[model samples]
Target: MLMENLLRSKEYWSLIEHGVVTAPANATAEQRQAANESKLCDLKVKNYLFQSIDRAILDTILTRDTSKDIWDALRRKYQGSTKVKRAQLQALRREFEVLEMGESESVNEYFARTLAIANRMTSHGEIVQQITVVEKILRSMTERFNYVVCSIEESNDVTLMSIDELQSSLLLHEQRMKGKQSHSEEQALKVSNG
Candidate 1:
């Protein structure tokens, strides 16, 4: 969260791209002042970053001079190298492969779980296509959802269909099933009474 906020700030842009100023040996008064101001700005940004993070991290970066150093250190520690990212993505892929809609879970719950993992996969640099998600949803759902899944596959372009549309259809089907159950209960009560 702090990282996201810092990335959004102007100071971060300056630190990462232009970097802090360094006054030359033969620098004029105005030039020295400008360089000092730039260094002050970097310090303020670094302080804000330190405040946002935990004490453990603070200790690790205490020796860092500029905001750029702190930022890069944090990024390296958390975001990891390319190999680390690849390993993370592979783990997420395994989790996705075995992801199944629980028999007792609601339509909303299942979609939420599925999208969370999908979003994580995307964050880790895996390109999870809409069609892949749709196919996963269609195949991994409970046995009761077979009819709706088949109908969706037959009537709509699964590749073009968004996850929201699929969720809506499943939610509607769940509502209809509940309504039918209540109607059947009413009919049974009436038959017994009459």
Candidate 2:
């Protein structure tokens, strides 16, 4: 039992060689800093990432067909991972595909359409390149959000930094963004009962 507990423990670093999870090639330091600067909740950031892609795809598809039934059918085809972050990205991808397919574009045409859209915008192409990129960005957003949220929920997750301590870091971030010393602002902390 003791051995099993040690094996399953998060802190139990061992010789079991896990594959290195790499960040995206295009994920520059500047982009990462900016992403860190605009710290929103995980769910919010995921949707923000998807909004433009979904709109462009939807427009392309609508040019071909306009059936709700067909749109719904197509959404399920490309939906992302069902667990946590990927699942959310997949949901947005499905929404975009549904909108795009609404215009009756063939699968080939769909890829072509996306290529055209990507060419017009720098970011649209990059986000779709690898699943790892999505995970990396989402992981950062989730970590910061959860840390702050956990600080707010002190009864549980006591391992996380305390609320007052996290607020100091948060204040520094806000001050840096504003180019001024921290001032009084009522920032609500997220508390989850779950």
Candidate 3:
């Protein structure tokens, strides 16, 4: 996907999609020039692919004559069968459904863990939306965040709330809780010392 995006950005994706352009012997100078440019772009794309992979993978694809060949080879080698992909997506969905914030986990840690799984699901073709992620986090937070979660849900249109906004609100509440806990500890220490 990244390679496709990169090629698209450079306007070189045609080389991958349409294969190499070959100008016939009767072609005009303009047509020959266009073919030459396409060949050059194809080489550039191949170079990018070569630079991105490790030595082991590069060795396997070294014989590939064109960027499209390399791309197809990598895709075939890495993209599992339909059944494998379906099974992986199913497992990810189950994991996402069961995910919950740990009692000792901070807001950021929980978000990171959830987002990681969400990203994996997306890569596997699951259409995970920001609202879905926000709702999941709100519902899966530890018991201590229950009141805040309720307040957020009651006050905000959760369907429109961004993941960043929800994260910031929860992070602020987490910080305040930590501050109060530390202050309470300090007060206890002062009383015992006295």
Candidate 4:
């Protein structure tokens, strides 16, 4: 959002590189005025960006004079090194690969779990392809979903199916199974009470 604002206002140049006051000593009055205006604009943008940060983080960067320094500091602290990113991605991949639906877990819960790991992987610069996610869901769901999973695998191309489609199918099956169980319980209760 900050980047969007900067881009919209054409003020991104201040953040993209180290901004320097470009006023020359021999410049005319108009040139000096324009230079001062540019400097003021840069300072305003820098201050705005700084103000958006939390107080605790603000303390860490209060001594940093330039906007570029503050931006780099924040980015480095959050983004980390390449090695750190690789390790984070690897951990997310392991979590995703080993993910399984608990026996009593609902389709929504399972999908949420899977998507969380996938999103983390994406944040760490890994591509969580839909096909990969679909295959993982197809293979990792509880046994209750086997029939529907088989039907899907047989009738639809799992490679081409979106995660939403698979999730909807599984959720429908889950709801139907739950309904049948409730109906069977009611019948059993009626027989016993009768």
Candidate 5:
């Protein structure tokens, strides 16, 4: 061991040139046995898991119906999610179906190409009958959007102040007549004086 250390100290790379590992020739039997035991231990632990480890785990998962756990696992997998994403996707689909949200160009393009349709519907100086139809459609769509966004609890304001009642309360005949006196005697006195 002293001789090997002396050689290693002299020149480190000289041992490699001479094709030799400067192991301790005078090592005790106990030291040699310990080194051998360590080598064996390392060899045994090498590549402990077989290639089938992944297949085994996959097989166990496939055989089981882990629906309850799956829901939990899926929830955990997706961190910080509010509502599930679905409405915008549906809206996009509707847009594609209608071509309004799809292969459409612009308002100018629509007018230029669909002149007869525009003329028939009376769109923007095209047709006269289109106004009522468009108004009715707009009213229907407005009511639908309002119904969707508002809940029953939020609709109490609408039930209170109503237009039908307001219209009924208005005395239209009294407002329309010109110089209609409250008392008929005043009118007769005015006529006699004249």
Candidate 6:
């Protein structure tokens, strides 16, 4: 996709799509000039492909006659079959569905975990919405956050809340929980020492 975008940006994609142009012996001067220009563009595209690949892969494709051949070879070598892709997507979906925040995990840590799976799913062609992620986080948080989750759900329109906003709110609640626990511990220590 990156190579395609680059070629598209430079208007060189047609050379790859249509192969190199060849003017016949009886062709007009303009026809010959156009063919020459197309061959030059094909070489440029080939150069770009050669530079992007590693030494080992380049060696395997060195015998390919044109940029289109090289591109097709690379695509076949790297792109998995439909069945394999489907299986991988299924696994990712299961992982996302079972995701839950760990007892000692911080808000950022949980968010990172969830978003990583979500991103992989997205790359596999799944449409993961922000609201779905937010709702998942809210419902899958540790039991200690139950009150905070309920309060947030009650006070906010979750459908409109961005993931960042939800994360920020949960992080503030987590900090307050930690602060209260530490303060209580300090009070208990003072009483015992007294």
Each candidate structure's count of clashing pairs: 0, 8, 0, 0, 1, 0
As a TM-score, model 6 comes out at: 0.71
lDDT (Cα) of model 1? 0.87
lDDT values for all models: 0.87, 0.37, 0.93, 0.84, 0.34, 0.92
Q: State the lDDT of candidate 1 residue by residue for 34-138, as single tens digits.
A: 899989888878878888889987999999888888888888998899999989999999999999999899899999999999999988878999889989999
Model 5 TM-score, 2 decimals: 0.15
Off by over 4 Å in 6: 1-74
> Over the stretch 1-194, how does candidate 5's per-residue lDDT look in tens digits?
23335435644323223322222678787877765654443332221211223564444434322222322333344322323224433443343233321133332332233333333333222233433323222233223233422432153343353333222222232243223644566889889998
Indicate the TM-score of model 2.
Answer: 0.18
What lDDT is reached at residue 116 by model 2?
Answer: 43
| Model 5 residue 136 distance off true place after TM-score fit, in angstroms | 48
Best by TM-score: 3
Candidate 2, lDDT over the whole model: 0.37
Worst 10 residues of 2 by lDDT: 12-21
- Score residue 159 of candidate 2 by CA lDDT: 38
Q: What is the TM-score of each candidate against the true structure?
A: 0.77, 0.18, 0.92, 0.77, 0.15, 0.71
**What tens digits encode model 2's per-residue C-alpha lDDT throughout 1-194?**
23224433633222112211233568888766644443322223233323534675655544422122223334444433345445455555654443332233333343344444433332222254433322222232323245533444454433343433433544554345345322223222222322
| Candidate 2 lDDT score at position 36 | 48
Per-residue C-alpha lDDT of model 3 across residues 72-177, encoded as one tens digit per residue: 8898788788888999999999999999999999999999999999999998999999999999999899999999999999999999999999999999999999
Q: What stretches of model 4 exceed 4 Å from their correct place?
A: 1-54
27 in model 6: Cα distance from truth in Å?
Answer: 9.2
Which residue pairs collide, candidate 5?
122-127
Candidate 3: where is the Cα deviation over 4 Å? none
Error of 5 at 153 (Å): 26
Candidate 1: clashing pairs of residues: none
Off by over 4 Å in 1: 1-11, 28-37, 40-44, 47-59, 182-194
TM-score ranking, best first: 3, 4, 1, 6, 2, 5
